[model samples]
Target: MPTLPLYRDDFYLSTAEAYVSAVHDDGAIELDQTCFYAASGGQPGDTGFLERADGSRIMLGETRHGADKSIILHHPLELFHSDMLKNPTADQSAPVVGEKLVLHVDWPRRYRLMRMHTACHLLSVVCPFPITGAAVGEEESRVDFDMSETIDKDAVTAELMRLVNENHPISVTWITDAELAANPGIVKSKNVRPPMGLGRVSLVCIGENSAVDSQPCGGTHVSETQEVGAIHIAKIEKKGKENRRFRIRFGVPE
Candidate 1:
C-alpha cells in the first residue's frame, strides 16, 4: 500500500494523524498516511514516537521505505517483545492493524538536519562544481565535489554565509520524469541521480525565481537560506585524484 507522504507538501509538518494499514512480523508498522520522512538521499530517517488512543506511546527507531518509495514503514524500537514473534497476541501494546495513532517527529533534531541540508545546497551554489557525493547531519554536513583545484575553505565559508545572509526563499516545485530527463544539466551530483519512475520529481528552488539555485532533491530543507544560519566550511580534503570533500558546520568560524 502506498502511504501518503505528507512531508512532501509541507516541510514544517511535525505531527499528523494516521491509521495502521499493516504490521510486519519484525515490528515495522505501515500507515495509511505519514509525516515521517523515509531514509533517502543521504538524509537519515525520522525518529520519534506514535501516540495511541490511551495516551501511551510507541517509540520508533526509524522510518524507511518498504518494498519501494510508496510503502513507508515505521519501526518500533522500544517496545519490541521477543515473545511476540512466537505469539502474535503476546504484546498487547504493539500496534494492531487498523489502529489509529498520532505521529510526532522529534522537531529539534529534525530542524537541525533541515538547516544542515539547506546549507549543503548553498555550498553547491558557491562551489558550482559537480558533486560526487554528500551527507546531511545535525551538527555537520559534507559535500564531495569532482574537482582537483585547491580552493580556500574560508572563502567558501564566506560565500555560503553571504547567501545565507541574503535570506533567499526556498520552495519546491514538481516536474514530471520526462521533464527531468530533458534537463539533465540541472543535476549537480556526479554519482547520485534523483530517483525517477515516481511520475514526478521535486525541485528545491532557492531564491526568487530560482536565481540562487534549483535542483532535484528528495531531502527536507528549510524555507529560507537564512534559516541555515552561520554555516561555515570547516575543512576541505582531497579524497582522490580529482575529488575534494567540503565539510560544513553550524556557527561562524572562530
Candidate 2:
C-alpha cells in the first residue's frame, strides 16, 4: 500500500503517529503514514526510531522507498550490523501489521540537512548555471554546474550570504504532472527530472512570490533562507571541460 508521506507537506514535522502496515522479512517496517523523508534527489534518507505503546523503541538506520516510490520503508539500525544483515531475521519484538507506533525523527541531524539543503538552493541561485549534479549533506554539500567560466569562490560565498541574510521566505507549491511537463524550464537539473508519476510535484520557491527561485524538488528544506545561517562556498573543482563542482560548507572558510 502507498504510504502517506507527511513530510512532503510539512517539512518541520519531526514526529508523527502511524500504524505499522507491514513488516518485511528483512525487518523493514512500513507505516500507514510517515514524517520521515526518504532518500531522494541527492538528499540522504532520514535516520530515527519508532516507538511502541509501551515506549520501547526500534532505531531506524534509514528510510527509503520500496519496490515502488509510494511505499516508504523504514530500516532498523540493527539491520545494518554485519551478522544481522547477512542472515536477516525479524526481531521477536518487531511490531506486527496494524500495530501503532510513534515515529521520531533525529531533529538535530535533520535540521542540519534542512539548513544545508536550503544552502544548496541558495548556491544555485547565486551560480545561476545548469546543475549537472548535487548532494545534500550535514557537514558539507556540493552542487555541480555545467559551465566552463571561472568564478571566484569568495565572490560566490558573499552572494550566498547576501541571500541568506536577506532571510527570504521559502514556500512550497504543487503543480500537476501535466503542468510540470508543460513548463519543463522550471527544472534546473540537466539530467534529472522531478518524480512525476505521482499526481503532483512540489515546487520549492524562495523569496516572496518566488523572486529568487522556483524549482521542482522532493526534499525537505528550511522555511526561511536565514535558517541556512553562516554558509560559504569552500571550493570549486573542475571536473570536466564544461563542468565545475562547488563545495558548500557550514561556516566561512578559514
Candidate 3:
C-alpha cells in the first residue's frame, strides 16, 4: 500500500489516471493511485466508476477502507456484478496490474457528502461546548460534546444557521507523522490512536478562525459554508455525564 491522492488534496480532481495494481472478484479493483476518497474519518467513501483504455467504464459500487488503511477498494456497479454472477469466472475480467484506467466519481453524490461534511464542522464550531466525537452520513450528521447540565436545541440550531449563513471556506493540509506523534491531540481515535508513523496526516481546517477547533480528519468537505442550505439541529440526546449528542439535518423549513 502507498500514499493515496484523496488524503493529499480534496478540492476536486480531474484528468488523473492510475494503473490497476490488483483486483478482487466481483469488480473490486486496487489501483496504483486513486482520487476516490475512502470511507474513513467518519465520512463515507466516494462513489463512481473506472474506465479502461478500451472505452469500457466499469462502474464503481462503493469505496471502502481496506484493512491496510493505505489502499482504497472500489466495488463495481451492480450490472457489472450481475455479469460476474452470470459467469463464476467473472473474476478473470478483473483489471490486472499495469492496466491503465480512468476513475470517475459520481459528482452529485460526492458533492452532497462534501456539503454534509462541512455542515458537521458547523455543528462543532457554531455550538458552545467542545466536541468529544462525531459521525457524518449522507442524509444526517451527529456529534457528541461535553456540555453543561442540559443542551439547548433551539440555541444550537440558531448558531449553526448563523455560521452556515456566513459561508466560511474550508481547507485541508498534511502534517508529518513525527509532528502528529509529538502532539497526540492532532487526530481523534478510539480508545487508542492509530499509528501516525505513516509519514503524514490530514488536517481539516474550517473558517480561518485560529480559535476554531482543529482535528485530524480524512473526510471530504465543501469549498464554502453557504452550500449547506437550510440546515437545523433535527435531534438531541443525553449520552451520559458531560456528553450530549446532536443530530443535524438539511432542507428543513427556516
Best lDDT among the predictions, by candidate number: 2
Residue 185 in model 3: shift from native, Å? Answer: 3.4
User: For every model shown, what is its TM-score relative to the native structure?
Assistant: 0.94, 0.94, 0.83
Enumerate residue pairs that collide in model 2.
none
lDDT of 2 by residue, 40-121 (tens): 8999999988887766678898799999889999999752223444656734367899999889999999999999999988
Residue 124, model 3: lDDT of: 66
Q: Write the per-residue lDDT of candidate 1 for residues 8-42, one digit (tens) a residue.
A: 88989999999999999998999999999898888
Give me candidate 2's TM-score against the actual structure: 0.94
What's the distance in Å from true for residue 201, model 3?
A: 1.6
- For model 3, how does the per-residue alpha-carbon lDDT over 1-254 read when each residue is reduced to its tens digit? 56366535754773368888777665677888888877766677777778776655677766886667776788877424445656666543567788998878888887777888888877767664666777777778888777755657778788888877877766776788777778886544433343354577767776786335466766677767788888888888988877888888877634
Root-mean-square deviation of each candidate, in angstroms?
A: 3.8, 4.0, 3.7
Q: Candidate 3: give the clashing pairs.
A: 61-75
Off by over 4 Å in 3: 1-3, 25-27, 79-92, 128-132, 186-195, 209-211
Give the Å shift of residue 3 in candidate 2: 0.6
RMSD in angstroms, candidate 3? Answer: 3.7
